[model samples]
Target: MRRFASCSLILAGGLSIVACTPDQPAAARQPVFEDVSFRQDYSKKYSATDTTLALSHVATDRNGAVQILSSRGLLQPYAGEFLYPGTLVADKSFRPLRDKKIRAISTYRQQRVYLDDKAVFSNAWAGTLYKKHTLPNAKHFAGGKDFSFLVSDGKKLQYLNDGIAWEGSAPAGLIDIVYDARRNAFMLLSPSEISVFSATEHTVTTFYTGKGLTCLALTNNAREWVVGTHAGYFTLDAASGRQRGTLQRKLPCADLTAVEEINGKLWFGSVRGAFMIRPDGKCNYYACKRWLPSDTVIDLAPGADSSVLVLTDRGLGEICFKSMTLADKAAYFGQQVRRRHIRHGFNATLENLEAGNLGTGTLDDSDNDGLWTCMYLAAEVFRHTVTGADDALENCRESMDALERLYTINPMHGFPSRSFERRGYKYDSEPWRRAEDPEWDWKSTTSSDEAIGHMFVYGVMAELMRDEDLKKRAVVLMDSLMQHVLDNNMYLVDWDGKPTTWGKWNPEYVNARPAMVGDRKINSSNIISMLQTAYYFTHREVYKEKAFELMTRQGYYENLMRPMREITTAPASADDWSKMLSEAWNHSDDEMYFLGYWGLYRYAFNDTLQANFREAIIDHWQAERPEKDALWNIMTAVTGAQQFDLDEAVWYLQEYPLDLVSWKVKNSDRGDIMKIDTNFRNQHTAEVLPPDELEICRHNANRFGLDGGNGGATEYSAGDIWLLPYWLGRYLGVIGTPDVVKP
Candidate 1:
């Protein structure tokens, strides 16, 4: 529509195009280069006014006959993408899925991907469904064609399969799939389970992954592969299910996606965008903010030319490999350059990864936490404010003479470790497939399975960097892991025939415990991440059930939380920790931890249930007040939904606070460079608290030391981002904050 890239557009149309920098006033720091791009597709606009969602995530088939789209990726502002419009699952007046509740949508030829909007309104939510302006096209392709399943009991899947009848106990949520040449099978993957069925038959090996798979990358060695899961990413033993080594993690984080190998370089995407390591073991990243114009790259497909195609929030953008430009911003304070705000080198993030800190290798001196900062910094693309920051994004152009090879389209979908290596990571291991356990006593945690999970997750991210042919192969790899990890023997429930500890502790229902015991059981959080994909691919009720079960049956307040009553201090691993909190309670059944509680709370839905959770949260956090600290206390207030005296807490939080994300986009209509979304003013209730107040609430807790034994903040997790949700909730006056209109 408008040509704006590579040209000096002092001012394009009505928008100011200034140089980028925080030093200059926001007005002066306009977008000097709009990062504009256009696809010279003589194919014409397709006459498809397709009033549908754009590609949130995308993948090209090995056959090149179809483009698979997921419409969902990581945890970002928008719920998910609206990629494919063909399979909206409709009745008569057909249209792409267009309901507000339809959180995400992706496409891959015949297959489609979807994620439910746990927020806004759900199917179980009756009031908003019948609204006058609601989307008439709202429907569930998996649960039922007519969009009948409600949110309260709706079993939204992580992925779906071609068979629509909804297979039971098949591990509900399925995400990616791949063809396995070794076994001539199709590996079906999901959060709850992984099923590898013969392309010619249905022989399978189902298994479970607690935190869900982060990525899946295939090695040049066809027979083996890598899998990144909740714990970490690692290479796997093709036959033995042994982990090679972990390539990513710092304390821990999940939701890994995207992976690829270009010109001897390896690449992968995690929370934000892509990353890469050079042939010589150097690493680098892509500046998504400058290169692709999206904070996160849902999918990265290599092009015929040594370039990469990135699917992001804005649209499909490409970075030409041969046309590489080292990002360098001019130093204003240095010599008052001609440009008001200087633009730095082409892509600093990439350079950093490959060269280590400040143009060095892994030996450049960095600690675990330091290494993580570098990784996250590289991933960080330009913030929305356009202050010229490197958010996560990486790339590789020069192709292998366009030979591009990747995951197969069948089962056993994954790569062997012999592919690529990073500064602190290597392809030194194989896939991990643990057998199931009926009970506890024999259960034990192994670094191997956990490591492979991480690899699978990263593999997904790497495939995104490949060409169309390779992208399709990546899906096949995903299918293999799902077959073995998600459904077949999910829960990693096997105890090597030892006395199982599963079901050892009572699954907490609200505030009550049903039964109890100990010895740590197989967990299920990792499977949750995979569900978003399964819901889209197969639409299996079983997938939805798993997510629902985890969300409902388990929680931090009652089920998995460590009893502080008899606590000495927080334990790192389950093995190191004690079961009894204060001698008053002892865990005998399943071993529940903070991860379970946090993971479960992530996908909570329902008005009454959410309220119920609110009460439990209040009770628990208030208890932790004894050891109240900034991190822990603020976390409790945000997620727990506890009530507090507003103006009072507000003053304190503002007086001393950390970071508070604003959900509403700021407007620039106020004669200022940017504007604030005042809509949140009327969203809060008098009884509820604001972010500032929320901060104050925590500090106050720290003062008296109420629940936590007055301890300090625990390591922050992605869950910490809940601040976005909390602020958004408050701004909308949906539950908290003063609902009084500003004007």
Candidate 2:
């Protein structure tokens, strides 16, 4: 296991002992399986302004195509289509199934059967019709083995097989009928009882009775029967009418509207949403716009390609699963970043999307453009260092060009602008200033976040890149940025000749904040990291001099070493700024601090300082463990800690939704999460929801925020948010290459 901190071969004069190349692989890496879980949601809006709100049932035919029953008839999903309802039509019938009114539908081994008030029909089987007995106003249908079927009109239950019909005692309050092939019987579900009618005996016998049964499903193994009710659901042994377990109520939602057994997993639908019982007993809840068009789940069924189709009041949510490795996911995100997230060489957001359509969006600038670009740049640098991919190198070069332009675009010598755009197209209200070139505009008021990101990437490039020009340019940029701070009295001077609000690292401004305020610790940590990075890369004595001065003379060491538990809200007597800054945990500071850790620990002035930096990083990681953040966990691994929640980090990566649309998601009213009292960190629950269930946001946003998002108007880049940590893990040898061939 080669640590990057110890792997650096460069001496004080920047002499390399060995040339790094793509062929050089890291040793002692653990291989991760390629089969990772990810979700793909399929939905269609009813109208331009309305989602489909009348879906009733969903099913999959033998051809592995999904059919959703809604008020508008059967609907199917088409490839490359979104937000358009594709109504299903009969294959060879004179009258299409879409035109005729369908009351009930079912799929058997080789046939898709449907029934109206008049007669039952099939798309596959064509047995002799039962002309002797007329249909008894059938409203439900279930297909059995070899054309054997059952129908119920909510009053009587009948078995129709081989042109003959046998009447069975109809259970009172009949709701649904399902065929159990293993038992060769029809399971009749009523409000409070289950009656099994054997085809051989032709007799209906009471099997089980419950207080408020709504639906029933036999497990795939035919060992247990799951029954749902208005309150919750429970299981029973299939052989006997005995309870398999106690009434299980700890679910995503207790009000079970529908239930289905798919792929050996029991999926429950409620008025609020749909959830699946994982093997571990915890529920993988699927709610909000991210999973469904609406949260009112009406039905659940097995879907095509190992997926689940959730029919809600508003359209369908097809949760599809595809086998992928972390590397495969990285490649997918690489294509995603190059496809739409690039804006003038900087990784940017796709804003003002039309109904979450990926093609109907435009790249837009943000306040932290430099920071975002540098994060993406670091990802590319890590990728180039690991795989030596030409595309990754090209990406790094292009982004490096953009970052270098930021320093020169503005009048200040080393003050990097937040972002830049062509002449007057900039629409943001941020302070946009004119560049020397009349055709361009540059944003001002760069903060310490950007500085830290810049230093981190620069240090990474200086340490890892094989290209001499890039390494030298990185060192030069580091020297320039640090010299600017030193020349301007340890501050990033803005266009108005004043320190940017967040760029002040001078002792006067930093020490003024109370000890408990997070700004004090974060500022001290970031400035020292910046100085160390500058000194390490350029071997400049001034950077080292200032770093030691900040540590010994100005009490910055004590500030940085303060235990994370000691950080709290400012006292009542504190100033308004300090109070506001310490009101709650700033997740943006976490991003800044972790990003700074790369340069802080790796580019330390001495081994003893490196040890202290490692301790500080581990302390911060301990505080952040509850979030289960992949980036934070992976970044903490750089410090060589024994345990950094690697499993949680992998879970974070695997559970992150592929859909980056900023769709409105609400979970504050969820019954599953155990709500905790408010605290300084604002953690809403004992455990945070998976990334996909929450709103789409950058790593800087709080993972515990229950609800947020614009109504599907924006899409975020995967570059900084996803690729950075994955590639960092790869470079650090904590994550291995795909176990299988690249797909």
Best by TM-score: 2
- Candidate 1 local lDDT, residue 38: 17
Q: Model 1 over residues 1-743: C-alpha lDDT tens digits?
A: 01112322233222222211111112121111221121111000011122344544443323322232333322211211111111221222212334334543332222333444432222223223321212233222222222222111123222222322122223355555544455454444565444554333334465334446644545555445556565545665554455566544531123456555444455555454444544643233432222334435455555434445555544444444322111111111111111111111111111122201112312111111111221111122111112221211321111110111111111122211111112233222222122122111111222212212322222322322324443443344334334444442343222232211321222331123222322211123234434323322333445445445554445422333333332232243322223232222222111122222222333222233334444544454454332323233333333434332232332222222221111111111111112223221111121222232122121112232111211111112111122222222222222232223122
Error of 1 at 508 (Å): 79
Q: Which whole-number lDDT from 0 to 100 does residue 248 have in model 2?
A: 83
Cα error of candidate 2 at position 336, Å: 0.5
Residues 604-682 of candidate 2: C-alpha lDDT, one tens digit per residue: 6655567778899999999999999999998987776758777888888877877788988878877668899999899
- C-alpha lDDT score of every prediction, in listed order: 0.30, 0.80
Backbone clash pairs for candidate 2 read: 52-314, 53-313
lDDT of 1 at 87: 24
Per-candidate TM-score against the hidden true structure: 0.27, 0.91
Ten-residue region with minimum lDDT total, candidate 1: 39-48
